[model samples]
Structure formats: C-alpha cells, structure tokens
Target: MERPGWAPPGVDITTPTSSRIYDYMLGGSHNFAADRAVAEQAIAAMPHLPAVLRENRRFLGRAVRHLAGEAGIDQFLDLGSGIPTAGNVHEITAGINPEARVVHVDIDPVAVAHSQAILTGHPYAAAVAGDLRRVGDVLAHPVVADLLDLDRPVAVLLVAALHFVPDDATAGAVLADLRDALAPGSHVAVSHASDDGRPPAGLRDAQSIYARADSAVTMRSRETLDAMLRGWELVPPGIVACPAWRPEPDDPPSAHFPGYGLVARLPHPA
Candidate 1:
C-alpha cells in the first residue's frame, strides 16, 4: 500500500497488510492507497466483503456486551486486535461496565504504536504487541498481568483474527494455552472466515488475494472450529453466520454471510 501522509514514520507502505485492508473495508481513513488496492482485489472476489467485515464488527460488539452484562465478566484479553476502530472490545465492555479492564494484543508494530498512543493513561486499557502463537509470552506480559485478573472470569475476544492462523496445529496450541490460563467461567468469543454454506469454488480468488498479503488466510470448516472448542460449552445459536449469531433489530436480513461467530464458556471440571 502507498503510504498515506498521515501514516507514522518507519511504517512500510508497500506491503499489503491485513489490518490496513480491514480498515479500508470498514470505511476508515487510516488505510493507504496500496491497502485500498488490495482491498478492492478482495472485493472483486467477494462482492460483499465490506458488508461482511461490518457484520463481523457488529457481532464483536454484541459478544463483548453479552460477556460484560450477562456473564459478569469485566476483564478482557483481545488477541490479534487490528487497528483500533469504532466499537472495539474495550469500547463495548466499558460501556457495560466502566471498570472493565482490557488488554489488546497484536503483532504489528504499527498497530502497537497506534494503540499505545490512543490507549495510554486510559487506566482500564493497555495495548501490547505479541504474536498470538506465542501464548506463553502473551500470558506473561506485564500489561496483560496488570490489567486482567486471570484468577477471575475474563472474556477472550478473537474477532476476525484467528482465521489468519494458517496451520491447525499452531492454532490449536495457541487456543489450548489460552484455555489453560483462563478461569473455569471465562468466556471465549470468536468470529472466523468460513466456506461451509457456500460452494467450494467461491473462496479461491479471495484466498489468492489474501495469499499476497502480510498474513495468509485460513478458512476453516465448522468441524475444525468445533474441535478447537473442545472444553468450552457453546452458547445459544452455536456456530452460525456472523450476522446471524445475534442480529440487531436494525440489521438487514440476508443469508450471504461469509463468516461464523459464537460465544462459549469454559466448563468447570467435574
């Protein structure tokens, strides 16, 4: 992506980034021309790319609010948090409980810098840079330790991020590590790209476009995703279309969804 004048120094503008492309899809001004170009390529493959991204964001808000309100969860650990956008995990949770503490994690240095600048001194929020694959490092981070109390229930938000984890082994290892650290009552909410309800040929071009980006895309099957939730008890609706997880009254009725979302809780050992 061509660097925008507003972009900070030292950030690469040529490489196509998932975060930047996501920002573009969300109608944000933070993306560059290079990002927009790649995003258009994706849109060409999937006409509803923008709408799908928005639906995913909306689902994220609903999941966070549900965790904060119904589950009495006030601590959050958001992995692979992209560039901060409207109605992020912290925003949604804080709205429900002002005392809620959130730690946003991502591997992008640019994202870390941006998050730091915006969330610094917010008291309840902290931004830390780390690969989601490095579960040990993420859990051991001082920011995470200081903001989130692992002994109590917490909400782990993995919105539109985990699908980027290419290998099943790597993804499972990361999830297992997180599950081990979370309390018995902790909730895990995730939204992942999928091809379950569509023809197999529908995802080829989209996958190709993502292959050219900074991160590779991994569209998992429902069975694969379910296996990843081995110990957690699924909430109502189970794994369904992102928009269908819990649609708002104002949401348009459509079945052309591109992702799956669900909220689940860790079960106490018998």
Candidate 2:
C-alpha cells in the first residue's frame, strides 16, 4: 500500500485505523482506503452510525464549552481525540481565556501527524501519539507536562474513546489514576457506547466490522458505566444521551445519539 503524504512514516497504511475510520465517518479527508473501506462496511450495516458520530462531535463541543465557560477550566486533555476536524477543542474553548492550552492524545500516527500540521501556528495547542491506557506515560509526557498544570483544574475528555479499551480492569485503572492525579475542581467528560438495548443484526455486524480495525468495540452496560464513574459529582442531566446532556436550541434532536454522556467534577477541599 502506498502511503499518502498525509500519513506519518510509521503508520501502516493498509490496515484500518479506528481514528481514521472515525475521521471518515465525520466526513473528514484524513483517512486512507483501508479506513474508508471499513467505515463503508460499518455504515452498510448500521446506517445511523454517521449521525451517531456527528452527535458525538456535537457533544464534544458542548462539553468543552461547559468546562471552559461554566467550570472556568483553562487546561484540556482530550483522550483518544480522533483526527483533527472542524469544531476542535482548542477552537471551541481557548478563545474564552488567552492562556488556555490543549493537548490532544491519540494512538493513531495519522491523527497525530494531521493534528501537529494543523496546529503549526497555534502555540497553545499540540498533539501526542500515545495509548491512553497507559495513564502514567500520558501524564508524564512532555507535551502534557508543559501545557497542563497538575495542581490546576483541567477538563479530561474521553469522547468515543473508552469503547476501544476492551479490558475492564485497564479502563477502570486508567480512570482511577487520572482521577487521583488531577487537582480538585477538575472535570471528566465522557461519551461512551452502551449495551442498553438489544442490538439489531446490522448493529451487530457493525461491531464485527470494527473488530477488523485497529481496535475492537466493547460496549458496557449502564451499570458498569456508572460504576466506572464512581467518586465524582455528576452534574445536572447526568449520564444522559449525548445530545441530551446539554442541547442547544439549534442542535439536532437527542434521539439520534444512542450512547451515554456525562460530565463529572471533583470537589474542592472543604
């Protein structure tokens, strides 16, 4: 497979990347043939998928706005942030505060490459290539260390990323470690795939299609999702559908989004 100019040196252009696939779903141009192929297959199975992804992106924008505007957070760490597309975190939140900084983390080299390229003149934002499951490495990373202050409030976004982590223990540990590392008043915004209703044949096929990609899908029940969010204060409209979390008047109806979204905050010291 010929590597496109946009793809990074170490990336395998033949195998489908989950990030690139997601990029394709969001109508972005950063994906390769393999990724597009997988995305098409998934779409064929579950046609509502593109709408779901768009809703997730909308949810991301709302989450960032709330964290920066309402919570007064200046630092942002977006975990598993897929390919840089419209409505990026920095664009949404950084204007509110001049000193605001953002560090986007993703496992895909293509995503890192595109993000770095797009962020060239944007001094306050950057991207790092690393697996979010390794909480220690991400926390200790140079980009993260430079842009984020451990003692200051930061919003950690896990948008559409947790489903790729198949192991329960690893996911829990990652969340727990992140919670312990941040200062009080920090917030975590998550939008996760759920196994609430019985999946149709097409949706099941979509899962199989993702299995062929770089990471397999793992949908958790609402109970497990709530448990994973222990020790945090759930804000109003807690743990609702993505659009249901905080929908703007012009935003799409919440019914299109089929997953759960929540924003939980760590309390300040009494």
Candidate 3:
C-alpha cells in the first residue's frame, strides 16, 4: 500500500492502530484499510460499536465543559488523544474560556501529525507524540511543559483511552505520577470501556480483533475501574455509565453502552 502524503514519518502504516480505528468509528477520514478492516470486524461482532464510540465522545465533551465551566480550569492535558474531530477538548474549552490552553498527547504518529496540522497558528494548543503509559516521558515532553503549568490547576483527560493500556501496574503508575505532578485541585476525567452487561463471546471477539491490531484492548470491572482512581475525590454521580453522568436532558440514554465515565479531583493541600 502506498503511504499517503499526510502520513507521518516513522509510523507503520500497514498495522491497524487504535487511534485510527477510533477515528474511523467516529466518522473521521484519517484511517487506513487495515484499521477499517479490524474496526469493521469488531462492529460485526457488536453492532452497537458506533453508538458506543459516539457516546464516549459526548462524555468527553461533557466532562471538558464541566472542567472548564464549573471547575475553572484554564489548561488541559489530553492523554491518548485520537485524531482530531468534532467537539475536541480545545474547541470545547475555547467556548467556555477563550484563553484556555491544551496539550494533546498520543502514541500514534498519525494522530499527532493531524493534530499538529489542525492546530497550526493556534498558540494555546499543541500536539505531541507520547505514550500515556510512560508518565515521565510524556510529562517531560517540551510541548507539554511549555503549554501546561504543573503548579496550576489543570484538567487531565483520559477519555476512551485507558483500555489500550494492558498493564495494571503501568496504568496505576501513570495515574499516581500524574497526581503527584499536578498541583492540588487538579482534576482527572476518565471514560473507560467495561465488559459488564455485554455478551461474553462478543466482547472476546472484539478484544481479539484489537489484540491483533497495534493496540490491545483490556476491559476492567467497575470495581477495578473505581480502584484505579484511588486517592482522588470523585465528583457527583461518580463512575456511572457514560451518558448517565450528568447527562443533558435530550441526550440519548446509554444504558446499553458498556463503559464508565467519572471525574475526580485531587484535594487542596492542608
């Protein structure tokens, strides 16, 4: 397959990446044939995959609004940010606070390249290539350090991203390091996929498809999900289904979506 002119250097265009697969699911055009093949297979196993992805995106917008509007956060760090699409973090925050800054980090070079292209001339926004599991490296990135102030309250978004991280220890360490890096009152917003209420065979099939791709999927129990947010104070309606967390009146009910969304805040120093 010939590489597209827009494709970033050093990225394996032949392999299906989670970021590109997700971009395809969200009706974006940044995906390749391999990503679409695996996404289509996963959708065949679970027809509701598109709806789930949309709901997760909505959850991300809602969480960002809360952080920017209610929490008064002026800076954001979006981990595992996929291909830029509608209702992105910077766009949502811009409406609430025009001066808000955003740093988007992703392991996928394609995603980072597209994000950088889209954010050109936007001084407050930037995109960098970094793996979320490597907390130190991501935090040490010059783009992140330049855009975000560790001493100020900022929102760290992990929406629909953590499932790709298979190692529990790495995930825990990432969260702990993030907590320690930010000043008191920093908020963490997460939306993670869950196997609860879904057919076992269907879930397994989807997992298998993702495992064969560049990023493997790992669904966690609600209890395990809750445990991952330890040491942070959960906001109201804590860790509920994506749409059930302070949903808009007209938002479609997401009871069938196998995912959880929550916002937790680190307490201010005593």
Structural similarity to truth (TM-score) of each candidate: 0.94, 0.96, 0.96
Candidate 2: C-alpha lDDT: 0.87
Once fitted onto the true fold, the runs of candidate 3 whose alpha carbons sit more than 4 angstroms away are 197-201
Model 2 agreement with the true structure over 1-270: per-residue lDDT tens digits:
667776677778899989989989988989889999999999999998988899989889998899999889999999999888988998898668767899999988888888998899887899998889998899899989988998898899999998899998888787788888889999999888876776644777898898999999888877788888777789888898788988999996745455789999988767
lDDT, residue 21, candidate 3: 93
Give me candidate 1's TM-score against the actual structure. Answer: 0.94
The Cα RMSD in angstroms, rounded to one decimal, for candidate 1 relative to the true structure is: 1.7
lDDT of each: 0.84, 0.87, 0.88
Give a tens-digit lDDT track for model 3, residues 123-236: 899999898988778878898889888889989999988888888777777788888888899999999888887554477788788787887888887888788777788999
Candidate 3 positional error at 230, Å = 1.9
Against the true structure, whose lDDT is highest? 3
Give, for candidate 3, the lowest lDDT window spanning 10 residues.
196-205
Backbone atom clashes (below 3 Å) for every candidate: 2, 0, 0
lDDT of 1 by residue, 1-270 (tens): 365565678888788789888988998777777778889988888787787788888898888888999899999999989889888877887788999999999987777777888897899999998998988899889989888888999888888888899999888777788788888999899999887765434466977887788898898988999999878899998999888887889877775676689999998999
